[model samples]
Target: MKVLSMILAGFVVGYAVSDIRPFDSLLSSTAEFGSPTTIVNGLTVLALTACLVSVALARSSARGVLVVAIGAVLVVVFRTVGMVTGMFGDWAGAVGAGALLGASAVLAGRHRAAQASLAVAAIGAGLLGTALDALLQADDGPVFVWDVAGAEDAVVPERAIVMVIAALGTALSLYQAHRDVALQSHETRRTLLVGLPLPIAAGVVSWFAGGHDSGDAVWLGALAGMAVLAVVAAFALPGRDGRVLLVLFASATIGSMGFAVEDSLQLAVSVALLVVGAGIGYRWPQLYVGLGGLLVVAGASLIEGYVALPSLSQFALPFVVAYALVSVLSTAPGSLAVALPALFTMSLPVTVFAASYQAGLSLSSDNAVATRTSEPDHLVLSLAGLVVVAVVTVACAVLMRRPTQNPAAR
Candidate 1:
């Protein structure tokens, strides 16, 4: 019976191979068409579908199902590396990576070792992807940095990948939490902690790695991904997911918004997004994210006011009002602790950097009508903002501090 099954498998494999080979001929014959890649891609998709079907149907007949799937992958990679490189930009590599990811996820489902290993790999992938981008795209040195100032197009694709990874991990993280499986709240927290320092570290490394226009795809990806997480965390997910998402979200928020937005109006638009996000986060248990959204408003308002509004008093006054607004709207009992640090982290770096950057640019000599110097005033505002941050952090720490109560006291 085994010999008969083997003979049948050989015949099936031979037929499949002969049938799938026509793609190359079809591709070559139609080279004069709209896009060779589109044709090849269509063929590849069809081939992939057939291969998947074979894998499914052949499982009961033969043990070579996985080999069939792998062979299909190799064919796609060969086509991609040779033809799709120029058209789709290394699409084969991405498809291959995705295959590996799916495989890892599957392995994780069945085995304990694979589950832990895949978790580590996922966390590392998220972090290393940023670092690799920083190292590779850093063109700021002798190589010469090249990019349109404030370009979002290059960033969009990277953001897509980052978000996919984040979304996948987030989904899996939630599932693991749900399963009472190997991964739990602590693992989720650990993954977030791994995520937090990465962007900052990538920023520094990119500077040294000859990062062009302030780190390439990775930094941008991180920023874009975190913004997405902040919204999703605030609005979409609940409970534990929300908390960890907040931590990861806040990690990327600082020093990001000013660079992410082009000007005051753009910043305002982002603030609006954050406001909607705040509403989402507000209804959730942890008021920290909502407070974080308020912090977003405060920071963006500060930047916008300083740039668009003439008098420092105009922006500063509104900024004060924003602070009051945050205080009034913050609804959680223990939220103040989270709120204070988020405010400090989000506000100080962004304010100081934006202020300094504005000061560096050549001011209009035509502005005799204005009394105070924009550069000096902005620098002062930066200084004052830092001081306020310092005072608030210290005061909050002192105020929130409580002596440990003995068990007997209860």
Candidate 2:
């Protein structure tokens, strides 16, 4: 029952965070300054910041629940009035929804050991939500056609359904929090301040790269900058948390390469593979194996770019990404400070890929086609990011293996 509640909480938060419909609606209804890509970038930063603040401030389980509940309420309000209020309400609601997600994870997994499972569940649920949203928005029959421009208008019934899920999840999480012994939040202001800027800056860089004026040089520079920052941040942080961040960076990079999946069935299959990989990682939790999987994903992507393989082979990408992420998280000391920031950082790569590849806006094809061929430049860019991630993953692994110095011995 406890696990179920956590899953529910994760699903709600995941759905709220991943669903781009509200933002899409906001952009369409009002004259937003930037393109869809820029808005997404800003929203990602806001969500990351909100997650950090909510987790840092929620000193107890009760506070965590309260924060999450408030976040849920804000999302519900956004869904209700987003069309009416234009941009500000939608943006504010997204931030609140992000806070709810961050707080709920902390509340559910109060101990270090449980944080990995909570993260896995939450991520899987979020991916599921993304797939479901696509299916729900399909214009003809059950088949969902991918549109890079943006999803069709906000589906009213779907919005209501998501709100209900968020409410129920919040209630369940509250009940579970009340039953369990309250765990004090371990996050500190110093750590929050130190860790906050990297992901936000990464998002900003990605947003800039995604802009119409930016070219391949800007995108490559952003990728290189993010890689350096992630590696430096990983080593700068003490113990396993840094390694966790590196692995998540790799996961995000690999996962973002899947932008070519054009239909709902392929997406559902990819998400299913993600769940399987998460389960495997939870059971084994091997860092090296996960690292190797990252390499395999990189290799496979390069191969697919040049060689014509069976289209179904693409599903392996998400599996490897999820496995790598969960494996590293399982080994780390569960801290929302690390987990939430790392998770948000994961979004930067996706933003970059979307902007660089001109996803949604450029990729328009017949619904009957299951997948589209990725451009050569996009493949090369993905390979470059993945190679950097692999290098960082190895460096992190080596650093993690080193013995800590004993003060008395020194």
Candidate 3:
């Protein structure tokens, strides 16, 4: 029952965080806001809200679950209202959903050892949610076209169903937490306050960067700065918070391959692989071994990007990403609120910058009338970033392997 509760919490959080097309639909409805950049920025704000709320409310499970329930209800209400009135329902519902994500993470993180299974469920569900959303909402193109005005309506019923499921899941988890879990009141740490600014700055930079028509230099600089900020924030946080934050940051950086897939079938396969990898990771949970495998797979994906490759090779990236995330989460100590939200926040800029860079490369090549088709230059950047992440992962893994002077800090 306890494990099941954690899994439920994870699934809801994962779904809420990954599913943002409804909000995109809202932005597209307005002529002035119909641009892809506008939609991305709006969605990014919604995600940042989740991260910020998660960090701010990390201390209490009771409060977190209450917020989760309220958020779930609001999602249903706002979505339904949006369908009928065509007003701000989408925005309101998205904010509610974001609250669900933030609060659910707090609840799930409260469960100590079971955090591994919860992490796996959360990540797998998140990938599955993305795939499902793409399958449901995609037009006739290989990529998701977000400019369509009524896209949110297509997923309204689905969103309501999931929000209900999330509510039920939160209730179950809350019950279990009170019944069986040894509840602890974590001290308000100065590190938590210090770490907050990094994500805010990253969010602002990503928002502005998204709106700009500048060259790749701006995007590259932003990406580099976001990476550095993530590292600094990870170290600035204390104990398990820092360790887990670093692991998640590394996992997310290398996991960019999974997010880059476009084909529907390939995406479905990737999601399945993510589930399988999560299971494997939960069973083993060796941080260094998982990081090593992740690094190797990332390198292979980078190489495959340049070479003509079979479609089957694309699935490997999601698997290693899930494996690495669960393995790290299983062993690393920290507040899930800190690590998960920080990862969510930092990823916004990384994702925007990567997409912008890829778009810039494609445009430049198009203008030059290049005949030979190949992967964008961003894969090289991802590969380079992975090498740095690998080094940090090793150091964090080593530190986590040692006994803590204060067990309570965990």
Candidate 4:
């Protein structure tokens, strides 16, 4: 149960943090409001501090203590710098600044060290949160094509502060809740070896395969890579965590592949993919896998539509189901919010395409029986896809609510 909670925490936090901040210049716009570099720099330092402090405070090892000290110094340095530069302000800033100093004093007493450490971590986290609002005011440049389409707009970049805090906090809390689940845990150690290579090799192979061979080779490679990751994670973590990864990656890969299939055959392939994906999600219930698959399907549908490969109406079902599945599957609020804009963007083409199809069908004369028959019977099938997602979502929620007894804790 603790492990599940921790994984949920990490997913929520990681998604939240990744949503608000721009990872690369291409991913964000920084010209209108002002430079985001300042806030980014500040948060980067704070995030590092939080991770260090969390690990340091929880572990009673020499190296852990050293990390804790370094983290403390970083918090002090960054907060002090923020104050001098007039970044941190008002009551929250004052409270955070005070806590920084008082935290040090509390740490001096062995009995209350954990409490003190928590305080410091809180201060650091609070400071980082403030930095996100400041970063939102950062200058965003001209609107690009994606911005107009409701895709990834450079106007508002999602920051990673929430994710970092959540991840660090969850890591710390989990470590405290179960000492056996710490950095030195057997699972963690084994994951270090398997998680490193499979995805990397898969990505490299997929990239080199390029625009030829109808995307088959790339799809197969992704499946193989995800399988490897699942095997390793299952052997190492051996529980819900491993199951989550397997489902998430497998669904994503299959959905993406379905989207990449020839437009004429999109309905058949997408249905097949959806079935395969939903089956995995049902059996595994991995949040990450479901979300990943949702994203891939959404992306592929957009590309397919753009190329005039698949009829626009053909995309509606996938778009609806994928987004709906994502919102329900992911525990991360940040990820959910980020996904909304993408959903809205994807909906436009699908909706436009559908309306046009219905109109064309209506305008056709009875004499044009061939045209009527050829009007692509994809709409009904697409709606069915949406129904599947809805059913899966309900089932997943119910499953998530069920109680599980954990003997490990006992």
By lDDT, who's the top model here?
Answer: 2
Q: Could you give candidate 2's per-residue lDDT for residues 273-365 as a string of tens digits?
A: 877887787788887888887777667777777788864335776677667776766322223444443554444432322322223544673
Task: Report how far off residue 242 is in candidate 4 (Å).
Answer: 2.5
Candidate 1 backbone collisions, by pair: 138-210, 138-211, 139-212
Among the numbered candidates, top TM-score falls to 2
Error of 3 at 68 (Å): 4.8
- TM-score attained by model 2: 0.75
Q: Please, what is the TM-score per model?
A: 0.25, 0.75, 0.71, 0.31
Q: How many Å off is the CA of 112 in candidate 3? A: 4.6
lDDT of 3 by residue, 71-119 (tens): 5545634463244234366566556655655555555544544675566
RMSD of each: 21.0, 7.4, 7.1, 17.1
How big is the RMSD of model 4? 17.1
Rank candidates by TM-score, best first.
2, 3, 4, 1
Question: How far does residue 108 in candidate 1 sit from its true spot (Å)?
Answer: 0.7
Off by over 4 Å in 1: 1-84, 110-113, 123-410
Where does model 4 exceed 4 Å of error? 1-188, 205-214, 236-241, 254-410
Model 2 C-alpha RMSD to native: 7.4
